[model samples]
Target: MTRKLTTLLLAATMLLGAVSASHAVDFKIKGVWNMNFEYGSGGNFTERGRSVNGNKAAHVTGWGRYGEDQFEAKSRVRLQLDAVASESLSGTVYFEIGGVTWGRSSKGGALGADGSNVVKIKHSYLDWVVPQTNVKVRMGIQRVFLPDFTTEASQAFDADVAGIVASAPINDNLSLSAFWVRPYNDNWAGDTQSPQNYLDNFDIFGLSAPVRLDGVNVTPWAMLGMFGSNTFRKGDDFYGKNSTGAGALGLAPAVYALKDSKVGRQLADAYSTVLWAGITGEVVKFDPFRVAASFNYGAVDTGVEALNRKGWYSALLAEYKLDWGTPGIYGWYSSGDDDNIKNGSERMPNVEANNESTNAMSSFGTLGTWTLGRDTLIGSTFAGTWGVGARVKDVSFFDKLKQTFHVNILGGTNSPSMAKYIKGAKGVDGHTSFTPDTGTGSADFNSANYYGLYLTSQDYAAEFGVTTTYQIYDNLRMLVEANYIALWLDQSRGVWGGYTATDGSRVGGNSTTDAWNVNVSFIYKF
Candidate 1:
């Protein structure tokens, strides 16, 4: 961190402390802490190796020989302080610390190195209710535009921004909200060699309506965003059409040629829009069945005329209560683009973008439920895929502990499109080619360069898991989980198991692997 940031943090802390000491305000402190360890095994492939003749070198991108038989330690803590001036007004200061490391740390009590653990202010916001009405306003740094599950689990949508949010109740069962946010700001920075890079910013606007029904609840929301950055600034006529008059002669030309030129700035803007609707309801009364569904659509300009930037995803789930536990089933689908959009090649102008948008669902952190197929087959529903899952929760033989079990089977909805996106080819070309990239170990499982984008020739995949939680105390718990996945690939498509060389050479041993993991966690809440 820079000195300026340190000073700002100190000032903010002092301000909060002063508020807490004031007679007009009452404050409360609360937090959650979690510590966990994970172990992974199986599925080890060479990242790169020479062919038998030594004339060809092949690179493979899939499960590599890393992260197997290794133990990982991860921990996180959230601290929050809320100061209330009145029932209608309050302010919050929230801090977070989290990190992951391979193996146990040797340091017994001292801080390890910079970035070994992350500590920062996660939220600082003020909430005020308008007198004589149910209108509330929240302003400052906070969370916005994420799903309920995402917010609760602190997973996919765990992003905070500086913004202002206004919400009003239309009636006892309906409410509306609007917000404007700056997700990224360059206002705080030290002198730099290239100041032009710091001139970019991101702005987001959103509106939502939540309605409550007799047996159901629904929330519909929409968001609009604009990203302005110097990343796209380049030579004249290079970014877009250069319609800003590079043709004009004289002093105007000189002005336009500068690094901070108006022409360059205007060309660095991108726009995107999102729409989502979600529903939760009691489907059956006597037997106690519940259902949930979410639908999402997104469009982006990407500032690239030849690239497609539109996609949609949807998920459905139903649960039933039994004498021993609750059982549920779920299915989801995401759209995909045609193979015409080749990898490493220029797409047609106005190409139809696939529904491969990132983090469309809350996968890993959803409490009491596991998105089995979603987590094992793919990181997200991007790139057009579908799957079905079944889960049972709260199978208890004892009062302090309960077990949950889940199984899932996943398949590609658009195999051709998946091939194109994963292996960067189409039809015969893609089928005959191997991916030229690096594989991942257990540690890099979901990274963008690894499993996030490595679903090449997967004909199908299945996953199963069991989790148990023990209540050590009212506010403390211990959890243990074991998971396994079996992935199958179409060998005819030379894109399985290992990577394809840049020149279309293929290398690898097997096309399938049974990967497994075990996790243990301790959590405390106050």
Candidate 2:
């Protein structure tokens, strides 16, 4: 499948190139392939799917896979429009072919258990840029990212065929971007490869109103965003229907009618019209000395009552470069309980059971890395989090040798993704109980007032690591890293699936799941 997709894409590119060459020929190509060799397998890294960035521990993988090592390659090529000649319009036509045990934000990066492998046209989208107006409009299939969606974050999916995106620079230092995108109309809209992601992909347009400011230093910008729902929710699609329906996935006709309420249509429309805004600024900046802040509030806009959760999230990031190593620190915190859910008395009702309801509505992506010898290592951690992490790095060693240390004593109370662990008594379903996933009825919030169990928010554990990468050649590099994490989950610290978690710590678990991790990766960029 991957080869065919690759061949088809390459052939298509060639054909297009030939056609354009003969006629208007406004097309150009851009491509990049990132390949990796990884070792130390135990952890969620290999199980859930492929980690494009080579992230080591996500619940998707368990602990034992950490020590395992292997190598793989992934890449994408794009056909672009020469801004000078074809005006400012461009689109990408590419595919991926490779094998890896790590999973990424999308199913394309999944690690197959059979090791048979995967290769296909992961994504392709087009964009139109207006250099003069500093405005770029991109439509077709595209990637959509949200503010606080942690894990593969963004409580959403891949691009939509009818999606639209526009980004324009308001001034020298500030710019704004807005997009109306989705991957599914309801549940059964397209390919069923990643049912959870694809079906759950929605029919919505998220708009980010314009905001401008000067520079990242003390500059303030305001942003307003609106999300418009699509036909998938109109009961004609496969996903938005009730779970019991024999159809693909449509809502119950009666419910869709809203019990004959005067505001049925309006309420439904408003539910889809989730609104959110934020103010951000970077006040301090002196080389490594940097300070930035932001506050965002938005309704869940799931188009469902109660599930139409509201949120307020904020963060403060600052950096300071030092001699030993560059020391950096930052943290973010947001309230997930802002959802009122229409008086909180509503039961999980009939609505399509596609994928929308399962979203974590989180923020942050994942950091990818690798390791070398046991104590010595190299890795990269870039996914966003609730902030509260600091680091110091020194790259003066052996030219390629870099000695560094970091501390991420950060944790959030309610994370859609499994950042923290499940502590205390297990729910009826083996999994520790929580809201959204299990609904509000399972675990009591502030009732007994316990960390992982009682709804009381949890604090972040202190996570720190030292890593280094050496350039073996201009296009290839070797990396290794070692990390030490002390989680604050006294009774039920954090739960890392792969390692050895006696209590809550494992291979690197605090009590049961905590243990030192050694990783390594060889990377070649083409």
Candidate 3:
């Protein structure tokens, strides 16, 4: 009787162990490393101010003036870990290291390679599905992007931020998603006398409905935000000095309006409101032929009439797939500021990953690839500009080799009269420089300039690019890219040429040379 009882106890213990093993969590890892070498020239377009001796000096461009080494090497690494218990629950963490430039001592790229504090947490989030329901929820710091079809990247908002997102399928053809994101909070250590956290939060709420049917897919989304007046105050580290936050959101016009209206001085002002709406869709019912389009509108109201902004943007794309490659044509247009700065700006506001970072509009450069690149010399956003381009993507003639070619023509939508309002403009040989505004205690208008080149109706540019890729192995690849741009600026007295020195002489020259860049990169994935 005792032996029989012991055998039963052993069987019960083994059964419990089997049940526990069934619930064990699985761990997975994935990562990528990229190394690159690049060279380029001619980003600066305007000439430096006239010399003291009254002789025209060599034109100074931003690249040359700032001592940007045209030729340099850089590398980046990213690692991601995921823990999964089942199809219903999971967690993820992503880390990034480097983009470290060779010979940069600060990032530990120097001789000893002892870079301090180089690792960054890019993403950390949890995902789970509700019991007995189709609802899915994600929380924590994660990537957030507004739906976009034409450009393949959100022009209004796309980045990583602390947020909560939930989604559910209502039917076979319809689904819904909603999110709440906090882009900034508590970064401001208020005045010594004021409370530490007074009016220092910027939050956004958004919703999107996706519809799918018969080779058709579309998403309509809307977002609303409550922006604290003091959210980007002067003393704060990241958002202060207009470095990030507002600047990263392409809100230069709003910043300019606030400073212009003098409303920013009043500490009593608590909050401003922002709203955006957009729709994007794609139709592949034609099979080999595809069409996609996107339209967006945004507005910001700060109570003061002179501190309001509203604008619209639209884009279209058409492509046909072939055995060897896909040929496509795309175009975009966005509203720009009128001649009156007092009426605020008409340019559409957006939230991009970084200042002047590339979007999918230019596929050969910047954000289009898994690895990042320098954006076009002209500008990165569709705001205040219009453009049309053609491309052949994924043209492959050999095994493990592919290539893409692109050509784009760009023009400005802003008024030429607005250029005259720019203050603290100065020219430095080999670069661009701005003089400080000592009188207003206000930020320099030049400092709020968002677009690298503030093109007006009189200015235009042409760009060409090509990218080649070769798979070196299952988890490794090599890439080579080349790009060129030609710019035409109106040098008339009514336009960019109107600037003059104290001596009433033209400050910069009338002509600018074209710019070009070449890049070689190796990428490994695991």
Global fold similarity of model 1 (TM-score): 0.70
The true-versus-predicted C-alpha distance at residue 305 of model 2, in Å, is: 6.0
TM-score of 2: 0.58
Residue-level lDDT of model 1, residues 169-270, one tens digit each, is 899789899888775555323234336435445566777788776766777766666544332223332222122211110001111111223332343234
The digit string of per-residue lDDT tens for model 2 on 11-98 reads 7667676766677545554444444433332212222122211122222333322323333223323232222236576566445454
Residue-pair clashes per candidate, as listed? 5, 97, 2
Report the lDDT of model 2 for residue 376.
10
User: What's the distance in Å from true for residue 514, model 3?
Assistant: 2.6
* TM-scores for all predictions: 0.70, 0.58, 0.85
Instruction: Give the distance in Å from residue 461's predicted Cα in candidate 1 to where it truly belongs.
Output: 1.4
lDDT of 3 by residue, 151-241 (tens): 8777788878899999999999999999999998987677864577778788999999999999999999999987776676665322222
Q: Model 3 scores what on Cα lDDT?
A: 0.69
State the lDDT at 84 in candidate 1.
86
Stretches of model 3 off by over 4 angstroms after superposition: 1-23, 45-67, 235-244, 254-261, 264-269, 353-360, 364-368, 423-448, 498-506, 509-513
- On lDDT, the leading prediction is 3
lDDT of 1: 0.48
**Residue runs of model 1 more than 4 Å from their true location after superposition:** 1-21, 43-69, 100-117, 148-158, 187-199, 229-287, 303-305, 342-377, 380-383, 414-458, 494-512
lDDT at 435, model 3: 27
Deviation of model 2 at 8, angstroms: 3.2
Q: lDDT score, residue 197, model 3?
A: 73
Q: Between the candidate structures 1 and 3, which one is better when assessed by TM-score?
A: 3
